[model samples]
Each structure stands twice: as C-alpha cells, then as structure tokens.
Target: MQLISTLATIGFVLPLFLALVGVLLARRDYGVAAAWGGGVMMALLVALAIRGVLRGDPDLPHFPSGHVTLAVAFYGGLLAIYLRGGLNRDRTAVPVILATLAAIALLEGVSRILLTEHTWVDVLGGFAVGSLGLLATGCPWAVRRIRAGSRLWLAATLAVATPIAFMTVGWLDGLIRHWVTL
Candidate 1:
C-alpha cells in the first residue's frame, strides 16, 4: 500500500508528463492532448484552492489526495482517450480495462485513508474534482481528431532528456546536502 501510494503521487509534474507522453505515444490529436493537460491542470488548481479554503494540515495540504486525483485523471483520461479515439479497436477489452483502472484507483484511495494520509472526505473530494474536470471538457475535445503530427522527436527528446534531468537534480541535491552539512 505504501509503495502503491508513493508510485501514484502525481506531485504536479507526473500527471502533466504522463498526459503529454501518453498522447504522444498514442498518436492522439492535439485537441485530445490539450484536453488531457487542461483537465489535469484544472483539477489540481481547484483542489489546491479548495484545500486553501477548508483549512486542513498547515504542514501539507491533504484535503484532496493528489495521488487519487492524477491517478484517476491520468488513467481515466487515458481510458477515455482510447475509448473516444478508437485507439483500441477491440471494444470488448475496454470495459475490462476501465474496471481494472477503477479498482486500482479505489485501492489507492483506500490505502491513503488506511495509512492516515487523508480522511474519507478528502478522498471523496479528490474523486469529485478529478471526475468533474474530465467531464467539463466533454468527450469531443477529449477525443478530437486534429492530430499533432510531431510525434517521434518530441517524445524521443523527452525520453532522452528525462534521465539527464534526473541526474542533474540528483547532483544538485548532493551539492546542496554537502553545503548544508558544512
């Protein structure tokens, strides 16, 4: 459960990265890609605002589990993208995949509570925010046919750049740690 929660922690960039990369990998339309990005941004922004108003945990905002938000939006929107775009021609497997995604989301949310990371209300709030953001854009744009043709280069660049970015971050952290210790 701990590992599952940690993996699903969208932490701002993960969902955005996943949305863009998933769209590129799927060869989805620009509109669909935009919708995916918008949906995620809207959910996170709204969740953050709600957390601000509600006043919970000064140390960290946990009113809406970002773990659950991006987990659902990223995967749910991926499913929507596949279903809407007809990426997967086999209609039969869609339901099974949806169920599996839902189950994983459910398990993740439950784990958050079991681990005392969030209350039930927090989890429910996350579910609502994620779903509402996805629905607000509607399926047409979410499934748009306007293709963003620059597939290989952008994704390939990210694939190469991501490791370098991580290495740089790691090096920076080590330097910062040494300076602090001094």
Candidate 2:
C-alpha cells in the first residue's frame, strides 16, 4: 500500500514538473499547453459532476477518481505527446519514457483499486477522461493555427494557469477528502 501510494504520488507530481519544463525548456507552444490545462480542468469538472449526480450529494460525490483523472489526463497525455516527437530528438528516448510512464500509470491504477481509493471503473473513467484531454491538445485538427504571438500568450496564460489549477484541485480535494474516501 505504501509503495503504491508513493508511486501514485510520484506519478501525480511528475506532470506538474514536466508541464513547467515543457513550457520553459522545451518551448512547448502555448496552445498545446492550454489544451493540456483545459483537459485537466475538464476532467476535474466532469468528475465532480459525476460524483455529485451519482452520489446524490454535492458534498459527498464519488465514482471517478480525481487523482487518477489528473494523472492520466496530464501525465499520460504529456507522455503520449512527448512520445510522438514533441520534445526529444533521440530515437531511443521514446520507448524508455513510454515504458516508465506506462508502468507508473498502471501501478497507480492498480494500487488505487487495491487500496479502495477508487474502483476499477473509476480508474477506467479517469483514463478515458485523460485520453480525451490528450486528444483535445494533441490532435492535429485541434492545433491547425500557428499565429504569431499565440505561443507567447498561451505560454503566459499556462504559466499562470497551471499552478493555479493544480492548487485549486488540491484545495478542493482536501476539502472533500474525507467524504470521498473509499
């Protein structure tokens, strides 16, 4: 349980750092960053709504795991995008990174289930939500425009939005931690 929790924590924290790095070092386009951020935001809202509706109580919602949702949406999405040549030049980098991320996500999902933090269904839901997020930003159709100054604006917006979104989710989860606990 502890091992799983640690892995889960790492998986959760990794994306925030990666997002920062991608934005600052990799010079990821702002629109892409916005897509990722937007996906995360969407997942949170959807999860919260599902929890409220199914659980029949806004104060004690359930069904989807927010942690898993964010992990899959942000980390999984980032990994998927990166593997597609978003940031690396080395040919060998993709496989290694993919394997490592896959392991982390798989482990996190399994642990969450075993620990009763979430059901398998919830985890799957998280994965689906995350995939949607990835698609939202990664799909070619979604990023057809490359206007000048767009990157700067998007990056600046994400620079502010990323941390704020992370903190907001953290605060929200903290508020409902007890109620949502498995």
Best-fitting candidate, scored by TM-score: 1
What lDDT tens digits, residue by residue, belong to model 2 across residues 1-182? 64644433423354454545455335545565566566666766677677667786543344666667666765676564454434334568667767877776677778788987777887887677666665665666435343344445435745675565555544544555656443
- Quote the positional error of residue 33 for candidate 2 in Å: 0.8
Worst 10 residues of 2 by lDDT: 6-15
Off by over 4 Å in 2: 6-28, 57-61, 84-89, 141-182
- Expressed as tens digits, the lDDT of each residue in 1-182 for candidate 1 is 88567545543335346545565556646566677678777886787687777665674467777767766776576556555544444568768878976776788789899999888887987888888667754556455533434333444645564455444544554564465321
The local lDDT score (0 to 100) that residue 58 gets in candidate 1 is 72
104 Cα displacement, candidate 1 (Å): 2.0
RMSD of each: 6.5, 6.9
Per-model tally of clashing residue pairs: 0, 0
